[model samples]
Target: MHIPELYCPIPSSVVVKDPEAGEELIRWGADQGFFSLDSDAANLVRAIDIPLWTALAHPMLKSADDRSFLNRWWTWGAVFEMRFDTNAGQELDGFFEKFMDSTARTQIRILSNNPPLRDGEDFSEPMDRTLVSLLRETEQRFGNPWRSRISRSLLASAESGVWEARANYLSQTPDFDLYQGLRRHSYGQTYITDCAMMAMGIDAEAKFLRHPVIEHIQYLVALYGGFVNDLNSLDRDLYANNRCSSVIAYRHQYGVTLDEAIRAVVDMCNGYLRSVLAIEAAMPDYGKYSFDDQEADQIDSFFYILKMLMRGNIDWYEVSPRYNGGWKPGGPIDPAPWG
Candidate 1:
């Protein structure tokens, strides 16, 4: 049984700019509980680590590496996930509410008969002023149509994760199709397209994303990602009272032992990986237009990035202590297998 190999050589250009970016991202992932060894860490780390990894691994061209979009998205994605565990609506609500409260307080001070003089006196504290300014700046930034577009895109992605999480928590029986669908969106697979486009150029994402074949390939990529996660976190998932796993779900559905369940998922993931490679190999037939050398290079780069993600995920999972150290394999079957 042959399996596709995985490895991503760091591009020299990326290394030149940020020599340690890849290593740092890997270390950050390990510490943030993506590894089995770090099982004691908060599960909420998923919100942070996944987005950050995606952002860090974004295949922006050398020229665009300095753009803040990736980092900004990573920050907001983490915040969104944290809010999911606590209160999803509160962060947005609180952002506005805090600003309004501060404004009202400032207005009241101005309307009152308070003296404007006094050496150490101020209408608002320094920290309050900073907060207000930040709020104003954030409002102004969002007013930009480009930022607004990305914000909407990210919000949609976050909503998918929220839905999938809910579904996983509620489901007891294994529904492979449902799991794949939810996993693709929940794991931020669509963002791979976005990142690839960013790497290619301004409209590159739009042009390539419009192709029906590319959409099909992207779906496979998402499945590969999700299954890799399912395999890596088998132990952690069981420990965390999580049954939203393909392996356990399969075992429940088929009444198979843990080892059999693992084998089935590995086969499923391998099939998806093979599909991705086949798409890469058949790019000429599927591409919407003929490309000159430059355009061809761009397309090749896009696929390379996608493969990098596929391989990078497996590498991260193997090395990360959060997935490896803490849990034992083949524990007692969880009685409630739906979750």
Candidate 2:
């Protein structure tokens, strides 16, 4: 396999994860049908090691034995399968779209302090009912805007999945601009970012989220995540004849070989990260918006967590058995160190 090195400035952390929490996640996911309780869960654990990856990628999850966070991570798999799994086909495409839309409305009403208009309308399936529990847990901690923000991110992702599915059916390849806008949600990084912000006590209001610097950082974080995923999962996507990948698109555009395409994608990830660095360099100590001492600390934590998320994501991809450890199949390239 050809595993091209990705360059980044943030160092990887060596934090250990809670095995008990990981096991509990497997059990819960089984009950939800995200995986079977036995071999399927074991294989998923081996391939994705999602618990470790979750702990690694989210700074707040590190050293925190919160099962709610772990459950939320497990629950997203169900959402991913429902929303983007190709085998789920147009059936889930429509079903999840309608379900998620209703879910959004429910979340809104809850935040607005309005009662549900009726019963059994919230969740049509047990698989999806977990989301309600997770939402309530989130509300108990971070109310209103954070919960609404979470709903928006999840809805944005569901909506993007519809577009992506249509593009796949039509054999259309998305340009960088179009993909950049949707990839943040379609790839589910925006939801992850939202949860991170909520956990860190950052304001989830649009004013701060849409602040130019913060927006750019969030976009780059998504881009970094998307590009790295494309780099590692190129093998799987290629096998599925999926052309919605930056590496594949670059290859087709330039008529380059797969190895060359992979290398170019690595450069793309580096560019995204360097842009994030530049945003940090230009921003004030409190970032795009300023506030009191406590708020300043929260904002600083946001930046710090952003850096950790970027670094930990790459680190997880590097070590995970998933997507063949993020390598393209060709056996032993230089494995040369990248910047």
Candidate 3:
């Protein structure tokens, strides 16, 4: 592989449990009705240990069942991308038609308003049923407010998927600067942090959500994760002819070697990590927002999950076989180059 070692600054007390977590992953999937052993989605997960990734990303989970719910929930973004972002993916227009046409009636409601699932309600399409189930479960565990906040990020995630699909549809690669903006969302950080928050079962008032410092931390978490993904997947993305990577963007815009571009991207990621740390430390008093003890705890969880997001799964990226195969006939869905 041409990828060089990346310097990730954030720390994680990651404990990737052994065969036990793997076995429990199945039971958790079965209990939640999200993952299937024989499905294409199952084929996709074989490339990397997603359950382990989920566990590593959200260490706040104290229970086995909690870890599994989040592991499966975190994997849904990939499943959605494969369904709508891959070659066999639905037409871009149809994706909007299927998912975006109704501003409030369908998924937005399921995500934000969060109506209860009836005994057999087709609240969403078959694929999205899992997401709806996950969201409802989030509401049950956390509360209507927490679920609503998570829903907002998830809506952004879906829209970001559309942005990514749009970029893929265009013959030319997205503009370097514009792509960075899109990358912040397209790479799944928004939903990743939100999923972690849901698992932690934390909530904040509207003012905290709108606070500038809080917003900046959220932005840095997403930016840092996107850079981490771009750096690690550089080899696989190059083989697949996908040039939307920030590393490639730097190299393309400036006459730099691939190695230089990789280094520059790594430096950029480190900078974001430093920024998150500084911001977390210098967080202004929330007294201005009249934050209660519960809201203050929610703010603390934000920092915790932010650290987890900024930690960037570098361990998994190094080991997980992510689409690094070249000219291979077939591969598992998780690591497959295209999706």
Candidate 4:
């Protein structure tokens, strides 16, 4: 329950600099075609926000040496972003309704003839299919076959168990236990969606979790005890009737003063940083060398960015205030803080 004393090595640059590397990475990403968006589609997306595209693309290009994996990661990210944008207009009701409808059909097929299930029984099929369909529709609309193909490939890989191992590992980690507890108690229903969104953001079309990057992101979330990202958006979530893990967790489990909660949140972030440093130290030279120095730098920058944002300064563009407000504990505090 205490913060670990781990430390990640600091990298030179917070952002990528090599133009040739950038171009090659983009081209390779285009060729792999995992996302629903093509070069043209990616370009269109860039038009909406060039910085965001660069932030996403630069890391993939820097870390992944394998042309195939790099391509798949970019493609998957591109397509997923497109689908997310397309669905942005939808309210929670519409999103859930669509999700539920897709789940029902997929569940039926999974249970009816897929063996290991008796007739008329319920089963928890993976939610990747719903995500896949959404990405496919986005790709079809944009005519971005490269991105779509990568998405399909990623889905195939996930079905084969490439990501499950990672998921199982993270879910069982001690850090995740504290994180999940906070999520379940404070955040409410929004906790699951936030987790799913984070999952979607980093997952490669449901194929593989981009090891270090995904792990890094999750590490940060767990460090904040799974609420910082959702903190700013508390009002919106409440408006939309969304539940947040931190809100629930703080109220039911760790009922304490705002000062105490903030302290705990900061400690969690510190713990997360330590955990990453530990992982990096243990990572083999060429064994899981997909992530390079540039990627590590980005992780560091983003982590600090979140740290600063949680402390107070609001950057609506980079950090949506409605959705990025830091989490504060709720309910009556105990006379003494729980150790």
Best by lDDT: 3
Candidate 3, overall lDDT?
A: 0.63
Winner on TM-score between 3 and 4 is 3
Q: How many collisions between residues are there in candidate 2? A: 1
Which candidate, 1 or 4, has the higher TM-score? 1
Off by over 4 Å in 1: 1-69, 82-153, 168-174, 200-205, 285-295, 324-339
lDDT of 3 by residue, 144-233 (tens): 777677777777766666666555555346656877786667646777776676677655454676777677777877877887878766
Q: Write the per-residue lDDT of candidate 4 for residues 137-196, one digit (tens) a residue.
A: 434533444343434333332231212222222232223344354342221112222222
Q: What is the C-alpha RMSD of each candidate to the true structure, in Å?
A: 11.3, 6.1, 4.5, 14.0
Instruction: Give the Cα error of residue 328 in candidate 1, in Å.
Output: 9.2
lDDT of 2 by residue, 1-339 (tens): 485677787877877766676567667676765557665334444446667677777656533645357445545543343344442223433553574466544533543435643454565544446666666667777786777777677667656766765665456777756765677777567777777667766877635556676777887887788777777766666655665777777777778888887887788788888888776676675453544444556656778778888888888876666544433333221110100
Candidate 4: count the clashes. Answer: 33
For every model shown, what is its TM-score relative to the native structure?
A: 0.59, 0.78, 0.78, 0.37
Q: Against the unseen true structure, what C-alpha lDDT does each candidate score?
A: 0.49, 0.63, 0.63, 0.35
RMSD of 2: 6.1
lDDT of 1: 0.49
Clash list (residue pairs), candidate 3: 44-333, 44-334
